[model samples]
Target: MSIFKSRVNTNSDTYNKNHADSLAAIETLRSLEQRAVTTSNKRRPVFEKRGQIPPHERLSRLLDPGLPFLQLHSLANYLVEDDNPETSIPGANLICGIGFIKGVRCMIWVDDSGIRAGSMTKTTMPTIISLQEIARRQKLPLVHLVESAGADLTTFLVESWAGSGGMFKNLARLSAAGIPTMVVLHGPSTAGGAYMPGMSDYVIGVKENGLAALAGAALVKAATGEVADERQLGGTEMHSTTSGLVEYLAEDDTHGLEIARDIVGRLNWNTRAKPPKRRPFDPPLYDPDELIGVVPKDYKASFDTREVIARLVDGSDFEEFKPRYGAATVCVQTSVMGYPCAMIGNNGPIDPQGATKAAQFFQLCDSANLPIIFLHNTTGYMVGTEYEQAGMIKHGAKMIQAVSNIRVPKISLYISASYGAGNYGMCGYAYEPDFLFSWPNSTSQVMGGEQASKTMGQIITAAAERRGEPVDQELIMREEKRIYDYFTKQESAFYTSGRVLDHGVIDPRDSRNVIGFALETCLEGRNRDLQPNAFGVSRM
Candidate 1:
């Protein structure tokens, strides 16, 4: 009860006052948090700016309005050890969710660039893995918006050995499973970060702001003595055009997001299955005769196949994918009558084996769920030692495998020359289309009679010269012409008669209607066998 007792009482009184004030502050903070959450809920799905506009808002601008964002890791709460106080966020650096674009829902994962350059902390691996798992389980399209400086140095030891290696295995599995994965390059993306786009079926980028590369210019310079800027290093212009690294090059971030959304819309099963909501057309229809003028009458004269596609698809409804990737072949998604379909056509005068790109295009078609339309007019794959040196055998085989895998509805229209492996690749007898329509002007055969004639002529000349005899040039020419006629006219009749070719003849002006009827008929059959769902496996 002396000086010590008096001091203790004084300290206890002061402690009680401070504790009451702290409790009041806690209640006030709770109320403020509740208000914020309520306000956020009332507001449209807007992204919060941690250090920059959140990925959801960035995606919101890219997608159509009111499309719900199905978040994959909405409740992922984790922290890094000794994390930078100034830059740390509760979820570390990764952000993953599911969202819709024009009602096309897709699983999305974007890096939070504000948090340690969007580096992946140890805890971040599960978020990505979990998202991918959900996407695979639901057969949803997977979209990745990468903007990272690679793995966090502090967490690399724990995450790299235990986190990413197995996680990427799942990513590769999801891709191979045909989940329709797409990657968008909104900003610079490097290292393991770059692989995200590489693994996806389609890669998109902003022309100037987006950058994607296996290694940065600095790293490349370190590995190999070379000089190049960021654009040369990984810019969209370089990757989109020169390297074929990126499929679609957008003018800006907003455009890139839109392109991504458009791509998803085309590939998503939910979107593709619907018959396009456009006004119905007459039963028997065809492209305008003007399309004839659009394509050069001369086979040697190459014109943009896209123009032909534009003419055929609903007015301005054709959406091209991987435009820059396969220069020799064209792959696009468009609606004939509001129904999504994939079109794979040769770009120029065909090659001997057909376009090298044809095989790739065939592979894409085989993997997709929607009906496919083939605008057959390929010369064939390029030949000679050059093609052999290019490993045409392996690449062409890859395409053959893809074509064989197609189980969906397929319609092939031979608008011009459908020769050799090219014809086979374009749903010729080998691929067995549900319906085949040969334009009145179209010719179908194993290979171009003109091309085969040339090769046969050379062999005849060489053998005659080797035997020291005068070559019967006239006889040889006659024989070659005979070979051409047999295949061009006779082969068409034989195959059509045998039911091997499906439908034999169509009018050039009615090519669109021919395709429309074929697709419509096939889709009618499909509906009888299949019932579509809100969420289903998407196109590759």
Candidate 2:
């Protein structure tokens, strides 16, 4: 019963500043998400005219009311197009999240046809792949509200054409792994996109709007001199009867969603096995609202990682692992909500001792079958002559090895700075964490802007001296400034989130709920049994 005592001074000037900065960051994230939703909502008129429900509305109808829907990559592809941020739309023309379908947890992807006719862009493909990956890993049933125009041919690239095959391959894998995939086709799904419904275990198509075809009328006419109508080639009627691609036909979008829900309900997904007994737990001793003040406004300013743990863990009761040795890397055994978990939080750079401690902690968590949550806020492993001599690389490699090989689920939350190997050690997205999220004030990069600029400046100055040439001080300053600005801008939470580096940026207040949901989702995967087959079920 080791309950942590709070050291956070909420009324302090520093705390107030930190809270204000965090609030501003959260507002920025909220505004961006609102812009994406507004972009979709603006198309309501068009969808109404077509007698089809808007993508978001369809999703709302599909999901169980009052249940939490964890949307992923809401601001994806923001400012990734041209340098003009004003014209750029976030969400990559797709709305995706995990939510309950008839009380059964499932992954849902909706084609935002309102934007670019629901076309797949360079930014959107990764989100699609990620959604599929989550479904496969979690064994969650997948439901898609399809109405995409497929890949945008105007900006088509060879790499995109080559990579498109993996989407269908994942569908096959999902079915083979005994995970159900249900698709509700509200509009066109042409070219390679037709395989979406083609590979699903259950497909519900709308009467007039649902169209799935290898080639549309225009393409058909261009390939051969034969003129054809789109509906005749691959309409819902054609697929439901002649082509046998559709399993169910509905009158409209609402009806299609109903059929999709009913299909998931009929899967008997929850009946496979009973979940483990729930544990009784106490809420955090500190207010979650205090989380905003825990993180400093200045990225370099130090804050106690335990302050964060105090507000997230049950009753602020954490059994610290190795309190004296390797104190920089803090490891604690605590429960998030009611679920037991091992958490690794960074108070500073990882020294040789810290790396070894983390590696050992990871193994212990793995052996106990408890999930690990990483609270990332480090510049990276310690450097300089002393650390190098102490086997920093060897110890760091051991930590990476432990993270890579651990069988239990890993969840990561970026609270502040995550730079260099610190990101890897803290389970950055590269390690394929079961779920990774970041606070809007967080930053991820190879190194800090000041450190990078200084290092580069020193290198340039040394190079000039070795070549018997005088270094231009102004030129060096300009180079350093450019490097600093670029890295600084790129490392911001918005930039990384737009690139789909993490799942999404979340408010500090929602940390507990988000982590709890992730734990429950991961636990379901651990408990559920899947019936695997040599090959997937194919359309006959």
Candidate 3:
């Protein structure tokens, strides 16, 4: 009976030990599962949700399908304050990467205004810096889609006090590097948030939806005692006309996006992978006799020079760039006799303050490897205190710089009214145009007839006052006419005497043949991209 009791106790002890071990193993698994659930809820990856795809998917759908996206700073993430948690909004507000549009790759950043007004915090800086580094290394295009209230107030103190650098330096570096950056102003982007767009290569504003500035209207009113609405503060029409800050105004967001694509298509670096194919065009011949009818005998009489350009270039070939920006000058890309050529001409009626856009157009031509043909008829750089205030000196210098750097052929045709800086700026011999030709009545001088009349009128009036006698009107008129005739006749000889100033004077009837032959010879062995290299690398 004793031996049977011991055996039963041993069996029970063994059973109890095995049961406890099984319970512990089950509890450990349950603990791991609970921890996993907690982490899954806290850290949400950017995968698609149950009912919706993300903004990136929508963007891809909007652009070309089957295009691959190369994400920049994909691992770096945004930080959300506890007060502005995900429950209060959609999530941490940032969508950033480098992607392709129609197979052309670019860096893109989209702000989510749905969450925390798309404010920039310390956390967002890392992503921007990463994108900047990539842009510098690869020389890819950068595009910023802005929709922000401003920087986050919660993190502003930390940023100002801590060891942190702003994004302005990086943006300026990229711009100077010629990386071809673009900004899309979609919604309100105020203060530091808008500065990135302002500093970009091209700033695009969507009509009513876009707004950008250093401060909001309310803040501006408080700071400077100025009362204005949001549009007056930072609107497309206001900046496009008044400030000259924004470039390429769009009707809406969709249009703004499309403009971004077109601007990229027009850039030199953006299409470095392949050369642009030349399309066929037929430019009408401009008879030398026709030139006589175009310019009136009087210098003051104005005629539409744009019509002359249209008649000379190929059918509807003129694609005017920055037309509204520079009214005093016209810069257009078109084909003359089915060959690509850039035409720069003088157009009157530009605001005396805004003449420097002409120089910007010249710089763009140089960068794009396009040759120039100057049609000379400019009064001079627009004169006024407003022009001085607008930094016209600095801007006008850029034209001289660009013309000097031009390696391709440039031809100058002096029609009328080429004087002062205008004469030098419009591919004059000082700036070294490859060929300088002129019409029969071409006048290249420092000033014009009316200017001579005014100076002589002042002199006559002053002499009469000194003698205590009445002014002699007939004498003044005769003196003015003599001065005008002397200068006009002398200036016309710039092309005739074979001086350093003139290449040759050509008849209007032979104008077409002259240009056609000149272009054919000048354009030979051009386009450095097609040349053979021992190492098979492009040098241009």
lDDT scores of the candidates, listed in order: 0.60, 0.91, 0.59
Sum up the clashes in candidate 1: 16
**Model 2: residue 46 alpha-carbon error in angstroms:** 0.9
**lDDT winner, 1 or 3:** 1
Q: Candidate 3's residue-wise lDDT over 1-540, tens digit each?
A: 001011112135443553344334334323433332343233224212322223343355435566544332221221123322122221124555556664555667776554455675444565565556555544557778777766666557754424224466777766666566778776677876666666776888877767888888888988998887998888876776778767878886677778877777676543344423355765454333344455543445575566556556666357777777766687788876667778888754333333466666666777777778888777777667987687667666666566667776787887656777777778786775655666545567777756867788899999999999999999988898988776665564222222224544444445555554445434542321221223211112
What's the candidate order when arranged by decreasing TM-score? 2, 1, 3
Tens-place lDDT digits, model 1, residues 147-206: 777875554685365567666676677766656778888777887777677677788977
What is candidate 2's lDDT per residue for 1-540, written digit by digit as tens? 999999888899999999999999999888888887888889899999999999999999999999999998897888786445666788989999999998899999999998888898777888888889989888899899999988877899999888888889999999999998889999999999999999998889999999999999999989996799888999999899998999899999989999888888888989874675457999999999999998985679999999999999999999999989899999999998789999999998999999999999999999999899999989999999999999999999999999999999999999999999989988998999999999999999999999989888998999999999999899889989999998888998888888888888899999999999999999898789888887888888
Residue range with the least summed lDDT across 10 consecutive positions in model 3: 1-10
- Which residue pairs in candidate 3 collide? 288-508, 288-509
TM-score for each model:
0.42, 0.99, 0.42
lDDT-superior candidate, 2 or 3: 2
Which stretches in model 1 have alpha-carbon errors above 4 Å? 1-287, 296-298, 349-368, 473-500, 529-540
